[model samples]
Target: MRTALRRRLLPAAAVFLLAALPACSSSSSDSGSGSGSDAAKATESGWSFTDDLGKTVKLDKAPTRIAGVNDQIVPLMNYGLEPVASWGYSSIKDDARFDDLDTSGVKQVGTAYGEIDLEELAAQRPDVIVSEVYPTDEKGTIDESQPDYGFKDLDQQKQIEAIAPVITIKLGGDGADVVERTTEFAEALGADAKTVAEAKERYETASAALTKAAKDNPVTVTSLYADTDGVSVAKAEDDPALNLYAGLGVKFFEPKPKGYYWGNYSWENAGQIGGDMWLLQQAGYDTAQLKKQPTVADDAALAAGQVHPWVSAALDYVSQADYMEQLAGWITDTKPLDD
Candidate 1:
């Protein structure tokens, strides 16, 4: 298996960073100005900034049009930017909440690993395109034999740049922490601080509740994904979804060998394992079907209700604040979901 170490860079990580990585470069597309005083103007809404890739990108002035592929759709919606096109065809049901935002209507792009219907995307004339690209074994071929979310390189970001200014968010890493990244998107969109502040408050409130719960009754959380082998458990140390539970002070099942790649294990043997909460991070399958395996078993989580499915709309950005709220709500019974 290829090493999974590099996939941890989260989009929010950029907030804590200003230095560019060797593989990435600031966009040279927008050469507006770079002076201290000019920097202020450049950051203003509608202005463009050169990204680390050197691409001159014009931030959406009235950014009414957008295109998001894969999980990128969630962050776009989290920042209140509805896309004109989405690439998750089979997972469209997974995005009902986001669809509700722009009830006007949107075009369904394509999603063969986010291959996308470039013609359709181009037709939309989006001001921004958000995508995650991982290095594949061949230039155009995507290796399905891999485990890490398929984001192996920044080439996809570069490709999107040809369409529009693209901002690549890192998928792995403790940096950015979700809320920070959401804030950055909000900042990019010139979204009102009220939205950002409310998200922050929700996260803080949720995190506090989870912390209290953890002190008295810490729970272990695990995120399982379907792999070619069988049921594959992504180590908590690197999986962002599981990382939330860890941050909330809950005990997470850390595998003996931890890395970004999915660890293989039989579903029939899942019952031998124990966790206070079994979070089903269903990328594209029914949890009921997964539970039927011999290794897995019916439980209180599914019965009395401890099994929490990651709500796509609820934790849209997985922003730090969003993480806090998600962890809090998932663990605490203090308030209703609307609360």
Candidate 2:
């Protein structure tokens, strides 16, 4: 972790989205995201999987050309699936989340919210199109399902579904179960078992190291995302990845979230909670501007230079391993608040 917690703007091709740490309002684990039963069942080159929405996609033969939203395409690529096209917050070429994977030949049809080049995606002739959903109500808790979080509306979802059987999965929980379930999906998609196994081992190893660090240097960690809109104090217990960290012995700055995943407040009221460690969003949070707020200006963590840039890890073994190792190192370096 850099002491300054520096993060520069991404390239013009890259775009930002609020979908990061996609929240779940339901207090129960995995409620915000869909159930964990969406596994790929393969039989003699045929494929079938039940999506989070309870929709079942059965293809007579496994689709050779797979397409997914930006968030999921990278993980499948790591699993040895070559995507023909992608649509998401950022193109694969510019998305930092895919920095570890080679996305040289994939086509990007969408780069921002509520926009997708359907014709362009159709040109790819994908066998199956995949997407992740975190359907939530206005209050930000899980509610009636949305067709596709990436598309503009129900019409767009219908158009895409017309082109190929869309396999949608709900993502939530402490992060471990989703990884395991998705591995089953990748395997069904014909992912190389050796590669997947190797990555899983690394993930487990990193998680163990994180658990050790949390026990050695105990500190209550706070997660924050700030911009011109306002400050959001994330309910660590509500966020799947943060909750996973909590289960690993790391104490989070647990506060009652008024909304789904966060408690929104004006900058004036931003410093409502105190913590030994502060993890700010790497991309959007503006700490320099936040100093204008009296409460944030006097925040002990900021004054002590204990702020760290938090990377929103992708939901995969590779991404999780990197994030965990980095976080574990930071936890080891962080001192207790009382110190």
Using lDDT, give the best candidate's number. Answer: 2
lDDT of 2: 0.69
* lDDT tens per residue, model 1, 1-339: 213322322111111111221122234545532322232223345565332223445553434566666466655555555567776534465554455455244676664443455556666776666544333321323343532232223554344455655654434333225435434544555555676667566666766776787766555665555433455555655545455656668666554443344555655455544455556654533566655654554643444456665433323333445445556666654211110
- What TM value does model 1 have? 0.67
* Global lDDT scores for all candidate models: 0.49, 0.69
Task: Give every collision pair in model 2.
Answer: none
Task: Output the lDDT of residue 11, model 2.
Answer: 15
For each candidate, give its TM-score against the true structure: 0.67, 0.84
Deviating ranges (above 4 Å) for candidate 2: 1-38, 135-142
Q: Which stretches of candidate 1 lie over 4 Å from their true place?
A: 1-46, 50-64, 89-100, 103-105, 133-160, 226-228, 257-261, 267-272, 284-291, 298-306, 311-339
lDDT of 2 by residue, 1-339 (tens): 111111111212232222221111111223222333344555785556665555666776666788878767777887878888897755566677878677777888888665788777777777778886652423324344445657666777777776777776556655576676666667767789899999999999999999999998888888877777666667765566776788788888865547656667776666676788888885565667667767688788887788887776767788788889988998888877644
RMSD vs true structure, all candidates: 9.6, 8.1
